[model samples]
Target: MTGSVRAAHTALALTNGLLIDGTGAEPIRAASVQVDSEGAITYAGPDSLAPEVASGTTTVNVGGNAILPGFFDCHVHFCLPGGAADIGLTMALPASLKVFQIAERMRTTLEAGVTSARDLMGVDVGFRMAIDAGVIAGPRLVLSVGIVSSTGGHGDMTQLSGINVLPYLQSPGCFPAVADGEDQVRAMTRRILQAGADVVKIAATGGVLTPTDRPDDVGMSVAEIRAVVEEARSRRGGVHVAAHAQGRRGIQNALDGGVDSIEHGYDLTTEQRAQMVDEGTFLVPTLSEVMGSLDPSAGPVALAKKALWQGKARTNFPAAVAAGVKIAAGTDAGAAPEHGHNLRELGLLVDNGLTSMQAIVAATRHSAELCQLDHLVGTLEAGKRADIVVSDGNPLSNIQLLGDPANILLVIKDGVVAKDRAGFLTDRPVSPR
Candidate 1:
């Protein structure tokens, strides 16, 4: 139950469960999933049609639990500690202490049934490499490494005291990401790419937390955003660009500049929603971050901004959902809710307009597609990575069940059991091959 790899029975199967599969399809009754030793799913369907596993393969009876694909969060910040005074707390802490906090957060996040995450900023490539090397327990990471911002933009750490505290938020592999015109934005984008960014994150508008600007204030111009998109696309693998677009003008500019996804769309217009659907653009609604930003410990400016936007966020997100825009679940963890509570976003999505199953797909398949890992994860099926989760009960009836880590019965990432709350693996002895 605690090892990095299963000892004798490398392959696994969870029989006698209801499988949700993350496909937005109706649940399959009497389901079973078979994972081969290589961490690939060999079978995932009705128990009647499931192929027989090898003799030594461990089989777990889930006691009629709900089986699902491991969840994925599209937007998260491992560096922030999800505190009301995040900026002050980060500035006060030493880099070494922050690293330990990041590790612990990642562990809790994985145990909460999140198998993969896309870190928007503040995390470097080293963390991803460490997880891949099995040096630590964490969800598979896709890192952005840095955020591209114009001077005094949301990502800029310069305060009224004339201190730039950006160093506290980044590791050695990250760059100081403040740029102005198109040329500077392009150079900054290249530097971030060289530092191993999987996605290019740019702030197209201001933010609530930054004292230097208001959320409605435009940050990057259309040409500057386009520069970032062009540079990222020129890369060998064609990196995608995500814009921190909160206001209507910034959102329109980002869409015009051809960014792949819009983050924190607090003022999304009806035209923007239609445009997003037509262009297949994804909307990552960080509702939890914005709504939870009304912490008493936050500064007066931040509190006021958060209060103003709270109503708009509730309205705009539901409108976007009704407009048929592609939705991806991203809590913007480390801002309000901590990493392990990522499932809270699903419930928020359901409240906004999405049904329970639609919200699950947004967290799983849609999020995977946004992270560019859909081919490997997102759904329970053959030829996919065996990143699976078994919930204590059906989430369709009560989606809030997934909001608590205690309800997550089993978490298997790449055929490795990361968390087994019900002793599904440890309770039974492995059969000899």
Candidate 2:
């Protein structure tokens, strides 16, 4: 009974720690967290202020470690394999194998302190259901199901090989939604909505990974762009569209089309940055993927779009920070050179002109807002879900400490101790929520 969904009547107390509530507030030293076993935070503040715990409570003393809201990655494609950034190798792989690989990657991601993820493309409700049903161990997922793209854009993983890639889409979690005009875009949006997508992701511009396509190319026409956003907006639960935009004009076009967030704004301008602020569009800088691609160790094909990202991003990123543009931490995980290294995105944000605390907030609360899950996750306030991480190192002073899994001693999701590196508890049951 130790870790097996300690009964909802049970209680868990995490005491003697520094609390970083993920609200951009100063960290509280020697704090405590009280979780009423249904997994809601009963208290999260100064240690002395904690309410009296009922008898039979399980307590964890983190030895002055840091307790914070579990991190979130707003942009990831869990359906893709790590180091499969190469087109031919990725295309040649069978969908059957890739499907199971997602479950394994999900477990790896959860242990990496990512309690939740917003899969920009190629994840359906089945995986989410499996995780919730205790059939798999992974992050809580908000799926886009599949990406909607204009014929030759980024999501158009249509290969040069004579093999018909269209059938690939019929598989559960495959590449894209290709459409030419507004009618086609609308039809595809409805189809994806019926697939149980929590959001709709569109390729507003061509991208680095797609062969023979320039990252700066404004791929999708405006009418089609507007149609996708319009259709998604009309859906129940207020489904929003996320645009994979990199070029300056394309970034503007995406905002103009009412995209909720812009992924990889590499060549953004000051005007575009200001517009993003005015329009309240969140920026998910997948800096880790960009910088990792530039490393010679990442392979040549993976490096094909190195120049597309490297230069302008470095300059405009800091400018966006200065202009008050909201930054969200997201590593384009699952593609080559990136996977469990999502925590590396925080350090990249710091290197790209954010302070340590700002970077932490970006990874936690801001990223949640970007994915439109702010109401439930993000800040560690009373009544919030008990998704928490206990880190061995103080992430505020040296942000890179989070990049090491060795420092992450505990990961608890929904009142269950999913991972316990310190042996504070004898077992890790992690029963379904």
Candidate 3:
């Protein structure tokens, strides 16, 4: 019963581990998790309270490791491979070759124990369908498909030379749109939705990576941003709107325009944080983006822009935490940090004033809430999908342990063993009795 747990038809039971349920609660020692064949967790609590396992059920003894809900990254980019300053590397590559690299990044992300992620841009619906149909391996994705930026804004992939080659790179389900005014914003929003966006991403401010604009410069006008929100609600009533907001003015504009989440909130004032808390807006502090972009190799334009905002996150992030703004984990993978390094955000969250448990909650529960997927996953409670991770060490004691894939001993998604470094389930194939 105690061996390598196979991804099979039989039930799964993980026992003898410390469970952090992703609810900001204290960890329970000697916990057990029971996943039914349909991939729903039937029980998750202290081992003494776990029901008796039936015959043929694979029982995994975690050996006092930490059991947690599968992590989530609220912001990531599967299109751009991380560790580079060139956001437009995919611009030159043909779509055929680019897709294969994107698929590999998805697999790498899955192996890192991230079960779900919200892709802010560059991932198309084809990738999502492939993962769902078992054609590829990756996290459950909530895709924006592409970003919406104003002329010369951050999402504008156009070169300063004025040649707009972005349309050439548009695939079947990906469409990045740039508009100048309310009417254009509305039309572009419709185009993004028509291209199969689960969420609408609007650039409320400039970004560090874009050469055309400064991060503090406001990108979209208030009316233009409102137009996007209005169009998104009309197209998909429950669809979420996220803003790539870094500066204070843009953050205020996004909040005023009714954005659901703020990405890379670099220069937030106390009033803005209070406003965000009042509006129930989530903040995805992508510390990984800041940390990863610090590479001097990225060039002077990028390095100077990065330097402008680098010291700000260290001060602002902890203050946002103290001001009670809802936090979610987002690494901005592909922008700076690589895909598999998603969990590094959790440790950065800890360093930014969140406790280890709170950091886990930010990655798991808060992220799910931001993605509007909390009911299906995010926690270890019964009735939730059996998306879980068993780490070789306790993350509460050393949160950085979750950052390393080697320490992730097991990864289960929807009751199927995705990765198992430990021999918890038997290698024997399930017999068709």
Tell me how many clashing residue pairs each candidate has. Answer: 0, 1, 7
Worst 10 residues of 2 by lDDT: 1-10
Q: What is the C-alpha local distance difference test score of candidate 3?
A: 0.85
lDDT of each: 0.88, 0.80, 0.85
Per-residue C-alpha lDDT of model 1 across residues 147-216, encoded as one tens digit per residue: 8999889888887989887787766556669999999999999999998888999999998877778889
- lDDT winner between 1 and 3, please give it: 1
Lowest summed lDDT across 10 adjacent residues in model 3 is found at: 424-433
Which has the better lDDT: candidate 1, or candidate 2? 1
| TM-score, one value per model | 0.96, 0.92, 0.94
TM-score, cand. 1: 0.96
Ranked by TM-score, the better of candidates 1 and 2 is 1
Off by over 4 Å in 3: 1-9, 85-92, 165-172, 235-237, 427-433
Off by over 4 Å in 2: 1-10, 84-96, 164-175, 294-304, 427-433
Clashing pairs in 3: 3-423, 3-424, 3-425, 4-423, 4-424, 4-425, 5-425
